[model samples]
Target: WVQKSLDVTFEEAVALRQAYLHRYGTTLGGLTAEHQVDVDDYLAFVHDIPIERYVRPNPRLAAMLSAIPLCKAVFTNATSEHAWRVLRALDVADRLEWVVGIREVDFNNKPRLEAYQRLLAFLHAQGPDCILVEDRVVNLRPGKRLGMTTVLVDATPEEEVDFAVGDVLEVGPLVARLLEAQND
Candidate 1:
């Protein structure tokens, strides 16, 4: 549905989804309300894509994440099953102390305060100090707004987020610095 309506490639579809999120709170809800598109078909199309390519293990990243003493969690709009699959594929599932997905949180997705609130509650964490790492600038915006320290992975210059890095591979040194700062 989204692919057909937007006439975009898979990458473009992801970008469009992100753009919609930036413009509206929810992609499916926004498309349905604004374009009168069928949500089921859009979801089906999304599920049709091969996710394996997008998910792969990064051992270096895993090591870095393991070094951080802060409790780590994954907050994603994807279903818990999907998120777990990706994490497992990435070989970092064990590093994460918690996994919060749309299904687990009553379909509340990122950019929504409810999702963040629920994640914080589940982690017994306070706002503002907790860190959130994401690949999308639009997704990082809400984290910043909620006072979390936001890091943008694979972000572009226009994003202008608090911290930007090329990939998860570079996160180790940064996390080390954060740990040093905390100890200091």
Candidate 2:
């Protein structure tokens, strides 16, 4: 669906996808900027998948999110519709204060400076006080550069991140400690 939407062969799509990420931060950004692809059509086509089949509801995750006392929101490269579906499926939609997706920032995705700036502006937030927890190390770079504390939710440790955890279970305590330190 993505290849057809982009009007490119599979191999061409793969190459262009990489090139797009390198240049425009997201395939949607590059396609719209360079090829004039319709943003709505592209997003709908690419995200038309069985989300429920992949995402199972987790009560533990919901409980963990409820335990955290900070204002929470989702910042994602996916469309808001997609984000909502996944969040709902996970049973954590209500816990979040905001959902910032690619559509919200005019198709700009993460690792892009403008997208980060727009997100912080939209949230009325400052960079230094924000904490970005993400699985991708590449995505954490921009947040770190903007002075946001970066948390890497990956298996291995990253020197660039302020904190690294193997999974979501470790996040609550680490965040609590950080918040406590700030209070002191």
Model 2 lDDT tens row, 65-179:
8889999889999987899999999999988999999878766688888788888988999999798999988888988999899999965888998889998878888889998
Global CA lDDT computed for model 1:
0.74
C-alpha lDDT of all candidate models, in order: 0.74, 0.86
**Each model's total of backbone clashes:** 0, 0
Q: What C-alpha lDDT, on a 0 to 100 scale, does residue 122 get in candidate 1?
A: 72
Query: In candidate 1, what are the lDDT values of residues 39-128, reduced to their tens digit?
Result: 556656666656678878878878888888777888877666677778888899899887887666665677777788887777777777
Q: Highest lDDT: which candidate? A: 2
> Could you tell me the lDDT of residue 54 within candidate 2?
98
Which regions of candidate 2 fall more than 4 Å away from where they truly are?
none
TM-score of each: 0.73, 0.91
